[model samples]
Target: AREAGAPAAELAEITEATAVALRIRRTLGQHRVREAQLTALFDTASDLAALRDLDAVLRAIVHRAKLLLGTDVTYLSLNDDAAGDTYMRVTDGSVAEAFQRVRLGMGEGLGGLVAQTARPYATGDYAADTRFHHTTTIDSAVLDEGLRAILGVPLRLGSRIIGVLYAADRAPREFTAGEVALLSSLADHAAIAIDGARLLEETRAALVDLNAASETIRTHSEAMRRAEEAHDQLTDLVLRGGGADDVAAALADILDGGILIHDADGAELARARTGPQPPPTPAVAASR
Candidate 1:
């Protein structure tokens, strides 16, 4: 157009049109990315709603995080209140054994800081980052795993921080604000699923205990009822001037077993048997 001596106004209009076209293309690309993210999140919520196993839900969360951010690795750590620390619970795209088993004390590393403060933290170079309290154990594991850049967000349930969700890379790279928010959103879903599953298990155990207690109470009630009936029958027998043999017979019938009566002088007065009877020893005979 320039060589053909096109007017300056026409050239400017063409340049403006090209710029508009580029902007529209960029906007469409962004919309596509947002749509994909929304779809992934919707699927995550669906998975959580149909949750059956806690471990499977956790694994899915980590895997989704890794895919969403296109990172080298993603993992989750859960706080152990009794142990006073956070330990790795699940991982995706991770291979190092030391890294998989690493445990971090409160405020010890990026994950620890996120757990302790209940906030998100990211570092482009974890080794050189001085914003966190570094420990030999945590640093060594990170080094072994070859993770340089790391981002961590708290898994929060109300005001409590139950764990940390992390995305890490082997090479130094700065994480963007959008990425932080995305990971934080995922952490929120993960936290609710974890807490819900735990509560469900606790409820199931309580119901089992309640059933056992009810059964025990029912058995005890039956025993007491039988004892009361037996006592009333025996009392009526004695009141009616029933002889020792009659009393023994009544006891044998009520108890569905044998009965023996002896006087204080160790002499057998009467005996009844439902089946066989062994002769009483001299010690048993003198028991009266």
Candidate 2:
């Protein structure tokens, strides 16, 4: 009986060991899945950088979030400077009509609050939270549709807020800390791309202004060259027409918009009429 009991005890111990090994394997598998998801997120983001169309990029961002997080809905809100309002850029059809209609202040709603604070907002029970402002659109459609979990990460350029990225699940669920970190990292990559595009636009505008200024300067310089040529012609004509005394009087007349001529010795020679002077004489010795 003792020998039989020993073998049974060994069998029980082996079963317990096998169960523990299975649990560890399961945990490792989950961790690997999470790591694979994060790797996919970064891969998608790296691919997106090659695209220049801002609208398409933003849409891709939302779509990818919904895919990686296994959420039914994803939304992106951007700050509209012209309207001084936060406007939705992407909302899966699951987004409520009310959310589409109303604009939220910088810190008013979930997305807005996330933008205002520059942090992530996570909730497993959005329906039960009074802090959530469902309004009529979401209250009837989304809440009723079973949107139980929410996550929002702010998009930023340096220290400034640009918008928010949001995801929602229909069933009550918990987001792992690793998931939140992955999302926030994705948001950071997006902000960097957005900032780069904006800076590129600004640089193009500045180049345009600089080219305009350079063109203006070139035009004024051409005008000055033309004026100088015309002045030299007028001066030569006056000097050729008059003697010292005659040229001096003419120079005085033209001096109020006139010309003076001096000999090579620096002696005052002639001032000529600005208007048509008598035709040049061979004996005038060209005013000098």
Kindly report which residue stretches of model 1 are placed more than 4 angstroms away from their true locations once superposed: 2-9, 260-266, 274-288
Residue-level lDDT of model 1, residues 37-66, one tens digit each, is: 878888887888688678888888999899
Please give the CA lDDT of all the candidate structures: 0.92, 0.74
Candidate 1, overall lDDT? 0.92
Candidate topping lDDT: 1
Q: After superposing candidate 2, which stretches have Cα over 4 Å from the reference?
A: 1-8, 51-53, 79-85, 90-102, 133-148, 157-159, 170-173, 227-288
Q: Count the backbone clashes (under 3 Å) in each candidate.
A: 0, 10
Please provide, for model 2 over 154-272, each residue's C-alpha lDDT reduced to its tens digit, 9 standing for 90 to 100.
Answer: 88878888988888888787877877887787788887776666777788789999999999999999888867765675577676884566546644544446665656654555555
Model 1 clash pairs? none
Worst 10 residues of 2 by lDDT: 271-280
